[model samples]
Target: MVTMTVSHKRKDALKDVWDAVSSGWGSVTSGGVWSNAETEQEFEARLQRWENSGLAHEEAKRLGQKPPRAPRGWHKRQYPEIKRGDKAKYGVIGWARAVEVTRGANGWHVHIHAVLVLEGRQQAHERAYALGRSMHVRWNKGIAKRGFTSSKEHGLRVDVSEGAERQLAEYLAKAGEPEKAVRNSVEKAGKALAREATLGQHKIAKRGGRTPFQI
Candidate 1:
């Protein structure tokens, strides 16, 4: 079964939860990470925009006016053609994401772990790689517009793999779990196996930093 937990901190999390539910049987999958350097002010401003959008929606509804259309988020705005079932474009049938935040020596670090389900077809690997590179380039440009910067090497990452639906599901499930719960579950599974299983399950932070759960 494709099991998972949901976090309401970001709207993207809910979308990811839906993707997990609807695309459990998908074949080829691609995983990605998008990150950038941000100061505390920039991070807070980002949160403010989310809050403002939500407030505007609520206010309009309460006033008996039609709620405004939600703004296309950064990812969608960057690639307006990423519609589900659009084979001519990216063939992105399903998408899921988990946003992680933690403080470190540099500052507050925020990044996204995303899983994309691709249509089953010939040359899936080539298609997946092309999409990843495109996302990386667009991501850099998008952040630049916001006055933030990211390194070419670490700003973005995308990896495509076939027949890993279950593994991807488990990774998303763990992303939303509390640190203590995940730790306990791993311990129950036995340290040796858990260590090996999680080796590539999530990305390690640069410079020996800890993930949200590890901190």
Candidate 2:
């Protein structure tokens, strides 16, 4: 199980990751490509498992249809650590850059939908892919294949491109607001979905697109 409490060293390390992502990187960030999924039904099944096991719906949403699942990526809530890494890395490497680490859950495997952008799409992806591999190696404390998409039947997904950062931020802001104030906002979003919800559109609202539902 993941530790809910942070030790001094852990806190410091987290700060380091935060610093890497937040530095004066750039307007465009490089994207990391990693995906894992089985089927739509399977995805929902994973979401249900998370909810049943106490994970928030926000986390489940991240586990949308995808492939190379995410680490510590359980359900709807988006993990800031993933995006933070991107923000820290590419923020300095390119012109206009941002990272979007989306979530997805399924029996197949849950992974992040990461994206990075820079002056050019081509170079941004190349750099982002290499960096992702390096980070995975660093974080996991081992060396692994580093590239834009996974190889050996794992590269089928892992979306990337511009606006991914903003898009992900907006998504998290709506679904997984942290404090009570923000969480209340996300709850309101739930109510909004109950109201404006369309057929097969019962998924959570767009992060920034919808206002928090009122009581």
Q: Model 1: how large is the Cα RMSD against the reference?
A: 19.7
Q: Which stretches of candidate 2 lie over 4 Å from their true place?
A: 1-89, 92-108, 117-122, 139-158, 162-215
Query: Per-residue lDDT of 1-215 in model 1, one digit per residue for the tens?
Result: 01122222233343443343223212123222222234557657766676577678778888999987654563244322212322235566666555455435554455555566677757877877676665655444444443344564665555555444433446548656776655555444323322322343364667755666666
Clashes of 2: 37
Q: Whose TM-score is greatest here?
A: 1
Report the error of model 2 at residue 73, Å.
39
Model 2 lDDT, residue 26, Cα:
16
